[model samples]
Target: MSDNKKLSYCFDVDGANFTSAGEASVKVKKRLREAGFDPETIRRVSIAMYEGEINMVIHAGGGKAEVVIEEDRIVIILTDEGPGIADIDQAMQEGFSTAPDNIRSLGFGAGMGLPNMKRYTDEMVIDSRLGKGTKITMTVYV
Candidate 1:
């Protein structure tokens, strides 16, 4: 079913700031909570979005994230103009990471970002082109 209702928010991810990662997701989560969404739903959406935000910062050198909240579901779209994913299959696998060692030192690059985002969301779509960019859209039912 298509949702006629939609809520959209835009955020900028900072690639150079590791500590600033997930800030967007945190804001989204707070808004969702204040809107009276259940804790479980809030957690799921926040976690998935947070991971996507982190990926954009690390692999894509930042990006734009759009969140659409409908009556029955929430849709998150993350777009980046950095290096694209070479192998989506491999990247989707848990424990596989292409992040640099420096990134690993920051507590990321565990290779679970994509996998975790998929696991938490009901639907996930990835559109990527080498040397061009990547777009990830994920959805979760309320």
Candidate 2:
């Protein structure tokens, strides 16, 4: 790839399908590997993106995920139109989840999604509007 070139990828997450929740992250991991990124960097990106995708599926009912690969960093953006998080601070706390019982039964929604996302990424920003939606942007330095 050219030094000045930047690669961007987008995926539509299906909230209704729990089995396919991590597909986007898996694809991103494959792309990063193909691009010869270090394993640690790829792992960070994949874990962060996976948590964000799961959150989108569990909380937002579905959303869009966009990843941009740059020379110094990788950026992941998740946007959803479902009911927005009412409290950003609470949502960021570890072990804090609002997922329903059914979702919890599936071995997910243990309240670690947001915390794990933040842990894996170098930087994370969340913009949410109640009754509207949420937009999360995360960056992992290469």
Candidate 3:
């Protein structure tokens, strides 16, 4: 692919199936590896994408994930139509999770989703509406 070309991938997250939560992220990892992305970049992209994928599964009841491979960076975008985040500020706090007891019992939803996503990426932007949905876009420079 040329530097001027952008390779994009899209996946529909199946929120109804917890077992398939990280499948999209895994695909992203494989794609990055095949594209010859550095290990560190691939790691960052994969982790961030995984966290977002889990969040969508546990909270949003499924969503959409998109990865765009650019010349110098990788961009991951997650969108959901489930109940939107009521408070982005509080949601970003580590360990502050609203996940139900059942989800926590499964060892998921520690509320580190947003924080970790921000930590692993160079830039993170969240666009959400309470009654509408949410859209998160994160970018990692290569």
Candidate 4:
């Protein structure tokens, strides 16, 4: 790939389908591998994006996921129109989860999503509104 070239991808996340939760991240991981990114970089991006995608599905009822591959870093943006996070600080705590019991029974919703996302990425930012939605941008340096 040319030094100036950038690869971008967009996907629609289906919140209603638990089976498809990690689809976007899986696709991203494949793309990163094909693009020759280092395994560690690809791993971090995949994990961070996967956590974000799950959050979008469980909290917002689905949303959009976008990935941008630049020369020095990878960017993952997740946007959802569900109820926004009311307490970002609390949510960042490792075991703090608001996931419903039904979702918990499915083996997810352990409340580690945000914390894991933050832990795996070099940078993470969350923009949320009380009744509107949330937008999370994460970057992993190559």
Error of 1 at 118 (Å): 0.4
Candidate 3 per-residue lDDT over residues 1-142, each given as its tens digit: 7677899999999999988889999999998999999999999999999999889988888999999999898999999997899989999999999999888888887888889999999999999998788999999999
The segments of candidate 2 whose C-alpha lies over 4 angstroms from its true place after superposition are none
Candidate 4 colliding pairs, count: 0
List lDDT for all candidates, in order: 0.92, 0.93, 0.92, 0.93
Which 10 consecutive residues of model 4 have the lowest summed lDDT?
1-10
Predicted candidate 1 versus true structure: per-residue lDDT over 13-119, tens digit per residue: 99888898989999999989987889999999999999999998888889999988888899999999989999999999999999999989988999999999999
* Count of backbone clashes, every candidate in sequence: 0, 0, 0, 0
Per-residue accuracy of model 2 over 28-59 as CA lDDT, tens digit each: 99999999999999999999999889988888
CA deviation > 4 Å runs, candidate 4: 1-3
**Model 1 clash number:** 0
Superposed by TM-score, candidate 3 places the C-alpha of residue 17 at a distance from the truth, in angstroms, of 0.4
List the candidates' TM-scores in order: 0.95, 0.96, 0.96, 0.96
Candidate 3: pairs in clash:
none
Kindly indicate the candidate among 1 and 4 with the higher lDDT: 4
